[model samples]
Target: MEVKQNNLIKSLRIQPLIVVIRLENNFFNISDKRENLLLKIEKLSNCGIKNIEIGWDSNPEWVNLILQIKKKFKSINIGVASITSRQSLDSIRSLDINYSMSPYFNKEIHLKAIKYNQLVIPGISNIENFKEAINLGYKIVKIYPASKLGVKFINELQGFKKKDMFFIGAGGIKSKNLKSLLKLGYDALVIGKELRNQKPDKDLKIWLKNC
Candidate 1:
């Protein structure tokens, strides 16, 4: 199933514009972590790029560093990520972040994020979790291993929603699948290894244009 091109989304959203940066892998200058994060955030800001999600579950220092990033770059939106880790709202309530996401969902974490009024995108790979999130008031859902399931399945899910719900795709995203994601019903995407090899700035711009 393909979207019939909604004029509202075309006008309001820069479709296919979500950039998910694995803070650990993308910013590889591990010698000085804080400085590394600042440099990446500042560079992206200088490039006139905005919207970034930083993943952290064990790196509590990331919470503080992200605050500094927000202070330094007011235009950028910061998000937190937890995958198969113990990241919880207790860890993030003090630090300022826009959202909390996981490659899979947990009832406790989801409930906590909701209480904090933090946007949460729980990952679900199958129909049961999908139905549960929809029933539990999730506006955004992450589709893990998006490359394996591919855009075809996402297109099928799009048919069930009345409004455009956020269907975020991760894993195995590349230049080849970018167009198909847009053609399908996915609302956003995250990348890691794809950006690690490219001229980050140029490739991002080219991707933005295509999305």
Candidate 2:
């Protein structure tokens, strides 16, 4: 049988929008609020967003929720982000996850993820880490805490990079500024905490369209 392509990278080739759903205390409440979470994802899907990140917060049960989402939305590329250790990769790998991302660059962690044949996107900020990631053949990377770095930094980095490395703008991303970042040529955006709104269905619909 032919092996399938990694969904995260495949989705990027299709579009550059990603909705990051953080499984925080909400994971504990998923049993009761499952439909609401599903609805939020459904709204994003309907709006043409096909990639999502399930922010891992040290909760093992969170993988179960990811499995559920994958089963329900076969076309959506679901990945676990905020990874820091080999253990996190192991857990996600056990679930047959095809993609993952970390908040910072770590050679060991990157190697381990590669060993699992996972499409690993490491966080990059300054020139040094970005160079190292590219040296390791990472074509796509995440610009984390982008709110702190601001749009100017991203513009400057994109202007000076060796190759056209795709960037996923994450950390403190909001619906208001998402379009501006996209206009600035960010390859993708990962919206998390701020997305858990009282009106997720309406908000997601608008946000996805705005992007």
Candidate 3:
């Protein structure tokens, strides 16, 4: 688990950005939706995206979809996100994914992840949760609703940051503000809705080139 965690940290440092892809329910046209998703991922791969997180779903076919994605895109680092329940954890356990993430910290969920030897990065919104995450042996954490917290919130936590600790800023992150946020303190940023809502804009394309 330690080695896997370290590898993920190292990969994040090199790329420093994770594009999250959330699939909406389209029970009637699941096949078309899956194809659309593949095309979107191909576009991201062309844009030099190195990491991606697919939101977990309760649908039985979700696991097979992930397997297909992994087989199709071997180069990109794939992770599961929105893992907030025991069922969600169990769903991905057999997938052999390198890491997964929860939107908020849950002691029971996190402990179960450890027992399974899966690296689940906990999400923390405040000092209290952040401290608890550290105590649980987490070196990587996500700051959800990062824009709401602002740069000052992360900067203030610098004093408490442990060596090798990694911070991933998510929610309300735009291509324009990405660099500034990373400079402020976040080790990486997660861009989801913005990219999914529209094609990768010029600024994002330029940024990916340098990344």
Candidate 1 local lDDT, 95-183, one digit each (tens)? 75666578887767666666666556788787677877777677567898888887667877776654746677887777556666756
Better of 1 and 3 by lDDT: 3
- C-alpha lDDT of all candidate models, in order: 0.64, 0.73, 0.87
The candidates, ranked best first by lDDT, are: 3, 2, 1
Off by over 4 Å in 2: 1-10, 198-207
Instruction: Report the C-alpha lDDT of model 3 over 113-166, residue by residue, as the tens digit.
Output: 998998888888899989998988888899988988887788877789998788
Misplaced by over 4 Å in model 1 are 1-12, 25-31, 83-87, 197-201, 209-211
Reference-based TM-score of each model: 0.79, 0.83, 0.96
| Top of the candidates by lDDT | 3
Lowest lDDT sum, 10 consecutive residues, model 2, at: 1-10
* Clash numbers, per candidate: 0, 0, 0
Alpha carbon deviation, residue 182, candidate 3 (Å): 1.1
Candidate 2, 106-166: lDDT as tens digits: 9898877777776668888787888888777777789987888888788877876756567
Error of 2 at 105 (Å): 1.3
